[model samples]
Structure formats: structure tokens, C-alpha cells
Target: MASIVFAPADLVVATSDDIKVRFAGADLAAELPAHVQAPPGAVGVRVMVSGVRGPETMQRDSGFESARLAWYQQRQDGGPAREGSAPTMPGMLVLERVGALLRDDVGTECPSVAGQVGGDGTEWKGSWTYLPHPPEAARTL
Candidate 1:
């Protein structure tokens, strides 16, 4: 009864134990070393992309609340402390990079990135969704 979140591109990461196989959160736990087990409720998966990958699953009560908090602080602080952040977690910025950041004002100025690579190279583009407030009373949408 666990839910999953998949990245548009694949991801690669390691585990506490050493086992050689593509790593995902729910589907591939059995293939992992005996020590790999999902917390009480979760799944398994694996994805390898762009020199970055990791297990892809989330928990209902995970520290997501804290994640947004840190993101807010970082965004407001403007990354002034790039060298050191107080208590870092892996998935902290991911929520902003993907689906969640699509609606934010960050991309207001769409810079013309392509058309001038000069060698037919592809430019990278991205968007995210942001809802910085608490769900209002959980009423019908």
C-alpha cells in the first residue's frame, strides 16, 4: 500500500550495503543486499541518469515539511551560504527542480538559450510548481 514518485530521468545511487544492480525504491528491494528494506510502508525502484541516481520512493510522514522550510530559507537567503548549510538532506531541492517548481515566478524571463549554440547543440530548459501556503482547510478543489 505504498505510493511512488518517479523522476523524468533515471538516477543512480548506492546503499548502506554493497549489491550491484539498478536501484529503485519499491520494485527491486529483494534484489538488493539482505539489509535493504523499506521503512514500514514503501516501495523500491531504480533509475540511472545524467551521472545522478538514487532510490525513488517517499513516505507519508517523511521530513517533507522541513524540506520546504529549508527551501524557503535558501531561496530568501539567495544561497549566501553555499559553502555550508545547516542539516542537509538529499531530496531537499529536488521538489523545486521538478514538477513542484513549474508555477513559480523564477522563470519569468525566458532567456533565449538555443538558436545560438552555433553547433546544433541542445540547451537545457526547466520549470517547477510552487504553493507556499498550507492547504486551506482541505476543501473540495
Candidate 2:
């Protein structure tokens, strides 16, 4: 019998025609399009997000240094529990994109960049970023 091994949940990422993501690895059946399939490849147009709580800190010395430092610390030391009353629900952004499938086996590990998506003070709406090497950059499907 062929043995099956599951990859780490966090290691499992999702790629579609519009947005490519490194999520907690959700059930793709519901998210997959009518004609899409498993082992999907990169799309020309790629997107990613970081910092789900409020907005992400921009790199450089301009500002938001403390917030960025805090996020980095949390990742290294494990997320610290907030002392005061935690806000109901976290800062989040919902992205919409097109879906396309890749024929070849793109490795499990995806390369991503941090980007900000909003101007709001309470949320960091940025994409985690995906880069398409082949046919390149696709619009929403």
C-alpha cells in the first residue's frame, strides 16, 4: 500500500488564478473554481498579506518601527497574549482575485514579499505577495 504523509498545516499554501497565498491550509474543495484542480501552479498576477492585526508596518526608518519590532518579537518568542481586554475578532482583510492552475509541480515552499494594503490606523491590510515566473501576471479570473 502507498503510504500518505501530510505536510505541516502552515506549510501548505494556496495558489489560484487571482491570488496566491500561504494560509493555514484551508480545504481547497470549496475554494477551488469549477475547472481548477490540485497541485496548482503560479499565476502571472500574485498577491500576499502580512499583519492581520491592524495595519502592517512599512519598512525603513520613516515610522511604524515599534509596531514592526513588536510583530517580529512575537514571531520569534511566540505571540504574546495581550494583557487588557482583547478586541473582538482580529484585524483582517479579505482579498479577491482570479484563479488559474499550473501544469508543472511548483515546490511546496513559495516565495513571498510583505506589502501594505490599507491606510486605516487599526488594521494592516497587506498582501503576502506571489511572483509568477512563467506566463506571468494575470488579472482577476
Instruction: State the lDDT of candidate 2 residue by residue for 1-141, as single tens digits.
Output: 111133343442443322333332111112222242334652322333323221222321124445555656666665763332322212232233322232223333333322234344523333433233322232112
Alpha-carbon TM-score of each model against the true structure: 0.18, 0.21
- Residue 5 lDDT in candidate 2: 30
In model 1, the runs with Cα more than 4 Å from the true position are 1-14, 17-57, 70-87, 91-141
TM-score of model 2 vs. true structure: 0.21
| Number of backbone-clashing residue pairs for each candidate, in the order shown | 25, 25
Worst lDDT 10-window in candidate 1: 114-123
| lDDT tens readout by residue for model 1, 64-96 | 446647766886787744445454333323321
* Model 1 TM-score, 2 decimals: 0.18
